[model samples]
Target: MTAIRANSLRNGPDEQGRFGIYGGRFVAETLMPLILDLEKAYRAAQVDPAFQAQVKDLGEHYTGRPSPLYFAERLTAQLGGARVYFKREELNHTGSHKLNNCIGQILLAQRMGKTRIIAETGAGQHGVATATVCARFGLPCTIFMGATDVKRQWPNVLRMKMLGAEVRPVTSGAGTLKDAMNEALRDWVTNVETTYYLIGTAAGPHPYPEMVRNFQSVIGEEIKAQFFEAEGKLPDAVVACVGGGSNAIGTFHAFLDDPSVRLYGAEAGGHGIDVENGHAASMTGGRPGVLHGNRTYLLQDADGQILEGHSISAGLDYPGVGPEHSYLHDTKRVTYVPITDNEALEAFQLCTKLEGIIPALESAHGLAEVIKLAPTMKKDETIVLCLSGRGDKDVESVGRYLGLIE
Candidate 1:
């Protein structure tokens, strides 16, 4: 296995600000000026000691950085192949990994003197995270979500509202995450002078993909240290679920140079083999296209209209994967797989039953992959899965599906 070295992020930007043809500021003329301003401010902030300290302090005190790399002994015993390790991001503020990027973007927005923040959410984790950061920083926040998601994830919608953010429902297209992103882009277009679009995923225009990944790389950094201490070396494999693939990228970044560590990104296999039946396996079924910002792996039609992605877990129901993931796939540095909704549900139930842990639906995709891979591997190997979010938001949907919704 050839290890994918993460050399680009450690270096300065190339002429076009790309991470080896994976990142570029592909945007409309209307947003170019504002995006350029953000790029300039972000560059300045990267060198500012005060800004660095502020972000670091907030990460420690607010978002609970350095989340534990806990060994799942019970899970390991049950699986009986590789030792199971979990990068517990579910314990972070807002109960998801989304807050890490949100905090950094909010601080950058503050440095740039932007007074308003806007975001899009599907499962509402990202929306809640952006709203939480805005509330902490005393900035006005607006979150756009699909009308369906707004209703399905009402608890998070309520959390965002309570945090003083205006939650707007997007009724366009399929009325989901993609539509929410479209609405957010429109809002940014209209309010470009005073608002900063805090994109939640790592798939957006040039700087966002790079910026968000940098903020999240802390996950891999911590995991690397912990894995060394625990196993006297690196893990044999690393895995995470992919929406726009921020969490997976973060977890995989540290292992890129390890050569022996196999990286896996589990895509949502919705309700089957047929993409229409159940799947959001962007890498498995998508083509290159432009959507919110950059050209990447997108589930689109012949006319280039984005398709509606489906998943039992709302967070994984995005129509695109990050550009970097597309690059990784092309380079054969990482393996991308699909976990069906049934497999995820089984893994979710199994983890809860075996270890008394209820993982987020998004994370369950990674767990589902473990259920598949573990049984076939030798008992000496190790697999570390990034549990990107907690499962509280999914209780209602799971309950309704199981006929337990009161």
Candidate 2:
């Protein structure tokens, strides 16, 4: 077995603030001042024991940290050869793992004296989660999303509005998550003073990937502790869907040194393999390029025009991924694969029917991979899957895809 150091996994930006050729503050001159201020505040608050306590308290009392590690008895029996366990992040506040990070960021925003919060969301889980925290803290909130996402994820859009956030829809480009993110960046550049950009994923600039990862490490921390208490041994594998890679990173962090524990990140395979304009398998089909301030694997053309990525799950339809994921893929520490749309849809229905659990479309990608892999594994081998979010946001889209809706 290859011995690995846990400390080595804890990495940040270079002196110039880049994460393995990805991540850096890229904002207009106006926002640069605010970015620097945020960096200083976040760095300080990060080390402050009192601030950490506050974040921890919220995680326990409010957002419900240590979400259950449930043995998937039915799923295991169905697979017949392997045991499956689910880290029930779907039980967390707002019905997703997103709030785990939002709560931490909002607390940091408050500590930093930022008055408003801004975020870009695709499936709206992150938007709704951020709005929920904003309401909890009495902070103003704004969420930018693609017009298409707003229509497809209307329930969550309504939830955000009900939570007192202004949900703006961006109609440019493909009018999807990427365009929405670009619009949010523009908003940040213009309103950096009174607003704190509460990024939902680990794909953004420095401090964001590091900050969101720290916020999300709760998943790994809990799974490890719970595995010990439940099985007296570690899980044989950890699996998660990677959009911007936050959830995968969260689930994989603690297991990095456990050489026998495999890690899998499932990217959206949209329709199929990388036919031009078809898939969101960025890790599989993309090349390193700069998009939205970070140098990471991006689906772009030769001239650097970012191409629109397709996915059955809006959340997973991204052009680029977090740099750490890029690093892990390159180092072969983690295995990255793509799950096709039909496969994910089948998994979505199977989980709903078999386990009585309706997972978010984004999370269905991971489940689909599990469906393919579990039957072939050893009966005693355990796999822990990060159920990243609930499926409410995707019901309409799925209905439409199934021709149940006009």
lDDT of 1 at 368: 93
- Give a tens-digit lDDT track for model 1, residues 1-406: 2333356324423556655556677778999999888888988988989988988898899988889988888888988898888999999999999999998899899888899999999999999999999999899999999998888888999999999999999999878898999889998999988999999988788788778887888899889998889899888989999989999988887777667889999998886637572578888888777777776788877888778978887788898888888878777788999888888888888888887888998999999998788877888898999999988888888788778876
In candidate 2, stretches whose alpha carbon ends up further than 4 angstroms from where it belongs are 1-7, 12-15
TM-score: model 1 vs. ground truth: 0.95
After superposing candidate 1 on the true structure, give the runs of residues whose Cα lies further than 4 Å from its correct spot.
1-13, 19-21
Each candidate structure's TM-score, on Cα atoms with residue i matched to residue i, is 0.95, 0.96
Residue pairs with clashing backbones, model 1: none
Q: Residues 233-345, candidate 2, lDDT per residue (tens digit)?
A: 98888899999989999888888777788999999889886578699988898888877766788898888889998998889989999887887888788999999999999
Error of 1 at 214 (Å): 0.3
